[model samples]
Target: MKLHELPDELHDLVHYSLKGGSEDFPEMRQFLGVTVRGDANLIWNKYKKLAKHEDKTAWREWVAQRKDSTAARREADEKRELLETRRRQIEERLLEAGWEAADLKFKPWSDGIQQWHELVEMPKQPRPLTDRVWKNLYAKLKPLLETNREERIEREYIKRKIRRRDWLEGVLYKLKRTEPPPLLKVKPRQSNSETLSSVFRSVTKRDVFPFVHDALKLPLIQQMNEDDIGIEEFREGIKEHQSKVEDFITDWQDKTRVYLVNLIQEEDREYSEILQPPKNMDLDAFARLSDDQKLLLRADSLFYVDTACFRTLMVDQPYDYGTALQTAYPSLPEYQPYDLGTEPVYEPEAPDLTVIHRYATAQEVARDLLEDLGKPNASFVEVNQLHYSCQRCHDKSARDWTSMLEHYINHKQIQAKVDKHASLLAEEGIVYRNVHDRSFSNDRPMIKPARRSSALGARVPVKMCKLCERKPIDLNVTLSIPRLEKHLLEVHNVNDPKPEVHYSLTLASMFGPSPGSDYEIEEPDEDNEEVEADNAPEEVPVEYYWPESSELEDEGEEEWAESDLQ
Candidate 1:
């Protein structure tokens, strides 16, 4: 009988039997729900005839395919059973080793990788984690981690990912050259990395990529390549990574010690170096250090750091750092004015800046001199106690220097007014008043002469915080320049650590308004006086004005703000 002409149940059995060249009449009868209704010899004979007559070669081929498939399944089952046995063996060993239960359990039981599948947790220590730890752990765990079972079979036919980056790098190199290379391992990794890079690029809008190809290039590996590359390309030329890995048994060490160090440590040892204070570095030595070093080392931590800036108004000619043309050479014996034919032995080394100031003091005369000096286009400025002078016009000015630079600020001809007042003081036989006199303030101390041993020598004015009123306005408080400076730095971040000192630079930074300064010198502007008055505490006294006695309308008679005539 033809196969289809038989009953549907018998026909299905025959087809199934033909698929593998095997017959089970009892199972066929059971499938047909006729097991209780006895014999099936007739149907069984029909199945054999269909198999033999229809195609003998096809039947043999099916039988061979079936045997191969059965053998594969049997082998797979044996491998799984063996792996389970091996994993159990490792578990017994590790449990006997007394590792924490929590740690022994690697994955979260569901989502992540299982405990037995991975090596131990790396870095297993407190911070500042270095290559030292990695090397040590790798040595201790090398034998336990590499198992034969895992090596034999591949999940998705790809080897386990951990501890194999370096091996993959080598394998990938070979794979690239090999036509139709093992793609199960290579293609997915490259595609995934490329996809990830595209996502990162899209999100960050950056041109950075995570991978070079199937192999991810780590910074440490790149570094290794840079340092070890020679005339010949050799196997595993990345020696830094190779040396760092403790295991030589497995050719697949990840070579990621340096990468881990960067991730875990606050400061990366390979790529960064922090400056420690030198025991005895000189000012010149510190000055000669590079500007990048200066920024990192903090200029204040070193000696008095400032730049001797050279400026030129010749716009067509760009400035050169090496040019010494505009340097202010000190007056020597050759520059002495002649008393007779010979120079005076006691002639001052440089002309006094007080004499220059006296000349520049007059509004009309100073204006004429400034115009004559060609608008004073360029000045070679030094960064010490910056003193002003009109060299071309007056050649005379005070050598009088003070670190308190607030005296330089003026607007609306205020400097001319101050100059006229000083000139008027001269008429009253009170000459040579110091530029930064501060005795007039009830809070300020008498301007005392400072000797070499004095603690009060060379002090600069610091920005005062308006909100800082925790202490009284006394010497130990805001009046203490250093204390005020510290407060400004720590609390407000309003002071510059290494402010560039220029002669014409405004002292508003020290006194009141500066760029990004929140504090304003409180004054009775009729418009906003009530607003300030409302904010003021009833028990506290308002602040005294920062102006000098000369600037005050009615307080000019005290004469106490004059020079320290010691």
Candidate 2:
């Protein structure tokens, strides 16, 4: 007999017998008076599945027959009547509000990601009649509904959207290129300055060449000239091209200024060696000037903006000086006229002052030691990397600049050593030697991961959340420090989020949007407004939004609204 022909009561016994040893199957076969098949477990499994399915089917049929009785059928009929009545009321209200039944239906969760799976399934079970649900439905549908004039306007908008998308894709195509930027690909002999002036005429554009030049630096450029840049490095630089370019430029500018301050501190180098007279000036006249006059000239080079060129344009033609100036350089705060002898002296920039005050005595002492050691151009990078041993303390242990500075302070033999540490003179008792010359290899300073000075304070705008990582969610969102903090507080219920603890210090030197970018958020204007009625009801039945109870439970924690993510 077939497995299905076996009595339902004997099915469990046959299954257990078949599931056991091969010898037990013969007894099962004798009882059923049928051949025991090869692979008894497989036969038993197939039989069990079919039996379970039949049992379920019979149970459903039994339920249906039970419902055919008076009480359950009447209750179901009443619910159906109520649901139909509610549906009619909703349709009437939507029609009164100038919307169709189709317009009031549920839409995809994200319009941008219009996949079939993203399509929202409307509830099969009737929702409870409530004011909140109706209000929410109305609020959601009201903006989508359109009059004839509004529909025409919407037609125009569709064209604009298509055009905008095409334009955006084109821009992205240029940005996504692995080859060097058009600005960086100019001929070798052509001056970067000239290239910057010609191609990057706009204030935003002009900075690009200098930024790329400085960041890649002279050695890399020379290497690239000999044989083009490595594809991997080139790809890295060009990835998220605009953001990387901007970051490079900002960093280069800051480092250049800091280097300039360091240059100013070098006693070994004379002003005459570093500063040159303007191209228009005669060398003999510049040489004849005193040190103070040369200093003044240096200051003028920084602070002086020539208004004479604009004045000539104003005098020669029908040009407004202010308008011309504004057009040429929109970045300038204001324009000031100066006589030939009255050119303004250069005042040090605020950033320069900030750098100067940052380490104070440590900086000055570090500079003196570097100058004395004949490594005046040595940066903090080298200072931290190389090993130093204190000659005064007679300690053979290696230390980096930070520890060396602290050690020097202790030798001051003063109270509040920590507070006044940086104030100590380097000439006092902190003579040091490069530990690379030392005998013990193990005594060399261990390399620590580089950390930015606290003074710099969130230079890179892009940040990643540790909380999100712990939750194992995507950190691809373009959030800055402040936004990351906001996300932590709002989404994770994390109070007083700190950057170092809750987010990474690692710079995103890869393909991603710039910090604070919300390019993913296409419907900015429509979603920005806070409509109280449009929100999901606080205590609405889960069946309305989520079909499954499991889904409803996950909705609170996992389901992020697109606007909130942005």
Candidate 3:
């Protein structure tokens, strides 16, 4: 095939061959007509002999070189195989001894075959030493010391223990060998010479006093020496002074009593018998008198009297009972009784006479009086004219009389009834007719027309339904049934049959029955049942079909058979 048309794998192989100097082969270059460059010599050498014919000598030389190359490759392969075998053996030994591959240390052989031999002889892994073995090793390698013997010995022991397992013991031993710090010495305390010198200097001052006598200049001290008195002597002096004051007070009291008695006697002579002094009076009897009597006796002793004598001295011709009682008994000190006078004597206020009176005229008053008497329909103009004409003949009394007469004439019950009737007539827009008798004419109101009733009567019509021939009936009733059925059929397409109607009954009964009643069943006719049976459909059952081999062959050969037959 052409290069472009070759399959992808074949195309790739051809392209590689051409680029790798396949075109440089003499046969290939000569056939393809391509030139080879010098750098293609390696490819040429590799493919040249394979592509070209060769002599026996050349074959022999090639075979010998090939044999030597094969031998060198075989030796390298054997050494690699040996190294792999040794690695596997080491891995196996470590695994059996419960050690990891990393625990084995295999040093590479760097010298010649002798070095390789020595490395092979060397152990692939060292055996782990036990605690006892380590201890023995530490003991053998431990150091011995002499100068500063304890510290040196401890250092040596630590080094050995670090290699063994006595870390705590080694630390303790080191601490034991360590020396303690030297103790500090205490010094003696010094005296305060400066304080002693200051105290001595103060004591030797020239101006300092040896003693003080403050008591020598005091008045209390002079008194104490003159009397040689202590607290008892001071208390005696206070008692003597208090006794002299008591005696002087007693003498002054006696002089005041005597002078009061003499002055009272002189006042008694001036007042006559009404002021005579009482005989044989004691302090208790004086105290028992009223306060007025006591004051009169103390200031004017002539007014004092014995209680029994004073009572007997009042005996004489029968005294005025009121005046004698007033004189003998004390008045109640003439206290004025509290005067809450009648309503505090307030002045009654006068009515306001200046207020303008909104008084009606004589005629107007008459009209108002008539209206008040329920004759509001009376003529005011006629009433006023009567009053004015009557006033021209007489005084205001005549005018008042005329107005009063008019008021009385209009105030009849018959007139009031007539007025009320007129008002009602005006309200209703009714005409009034005069009923005239011999002496009088009265208004007689005509009756008003009656209003229409608003009550909703029955919806029953005065006509009959033309289609159903239902009569003595309402038109609305006829419409309701057909209208309801039409709405059900046209709007909801309900296929229910029309309800039966009885004209003799009310319309309510005709529409009252429910639609779901099975007892009201609509029976089908014989013709309808026959028609339904004629339109009934047939039924068929489903079946599964499988083709036999013969049938399949027959179907397959049918096309051939048809061809042959034609």
Per-candidate local distance difference test = 0.28, 0.35, 0.28
Give a tens-digit lDDT track for model 2, residues 495-544: 67666566665443456544433222111111111101111112211111
lDDT of 3 by residue, 1-566 (tens): 23333333222122222223342363442233222244234333533464365556664555456456645654555455555655465446435746433223221211122432333333243223445643543343222111123332333332222211122122222222221110111111111121232232111001101010211222442353345333234324324444442343344334433443343344343321222222232334334443322322221121121223345632121111111222233221111111111122111221121221211122233333333333332222111112111111111121222334332232232234445656653554333221111112123211111111223333422211231231211122232343434433432244463333222222333454332211111111111110000111222222221112212221113211111100
Q: Per-residue lDDT for 226-332 in model 1, tens only?
A: 44322112123433344432132122212222222222232322222222222232344334544333222211111110122323321111111111111222322
The best-first sequence of candidates by lDDT reads: 2, 1, 3
lDDT of model 2 at position 369: 47
> Please, what is the TM-score per model?
0.16, 0.24, 0.14
What's the distance in Å from true for residue 70, model 1?
0.6
**Which of the two, 1 or 3, has more TM-score?**
1
Span of ten consecutive residues with least summed lDDT in model 3: 203-212
Root-mean-square deviation of candidate 3: 63.9
Model 2 segments more than 4 A misplaced:
1-124, 127-360, 371-385, 391-397, 406-566
After TM-score superposition, the amount by which residue 357's alpha carbon in candidate 1 deviates from its true location, in angstroms, is 34
**lDDT of model number 3:** 0.28
* Reference-based lDDT, residue 300, model 3: 13
Residue 137 shift from truth in candidate 3, angstroms: 27
